[model samples]
Target: MAVGLWLVGRRAATTNQPQLATWRLTLALPCLALPCLALPCLALPCLALPCLGSWLLALGSWFLMSDLDA
Candidate 1:
């Protein structure tokens, strides 16, 4: 979350162009992909924690990146 926000902040600092907005969205997308990607590793309990944590983190990151009006 912190890093995503930091990246958004950095990008926002430069410009608010549609391209940059697209870039932010692109950067933010990994969060959604993470949970799905984690599924394959869930067969192992030890792998589950990190994947679950990543899923949660990514979900949170998506929210932080997404605008309410959007």
Candidate 2:
């Protein structure tokens, strides 16, 4: 879903639709972040602290990037 949105946004940009591009790209951010937020829960018992930290970092970065878009 994230990849699809990103591609759609790129296509919109090349076609001169700035608003569509921005909206799709903005939507993609959370889609990208969803896996990061989910992975820790799925792998918690096996991966523990390291997995949590990395996913948290990813989630944080996603939030930061999303904020920049706003």
Model 1 TM-score relative to the real fold: 0.36
Task: Indicate which candidate wins on lDDT.
Answer: 2
lDDT for 8 in candidate 1 is: 68
**Model 2 steric clash pairs:** none
**Model 2 alpha-carbon drift over 4 Å, by segment:** 36-70
State the lDDT at 67 in candidate 1: 65
TM-score of every candidate relative to the true structure: 0.36, 0.40
Residue-level lDDT tens digits of model 2 in 45-70: 33444565776899899999999999
Best candidate (score: TM-score): 2
**Cα RMSD, model 1:** 15.7
TM-score of candidate 2 to 2 decimals:
0.40
| Candidate 2, lDDT over the whole model | 0.64
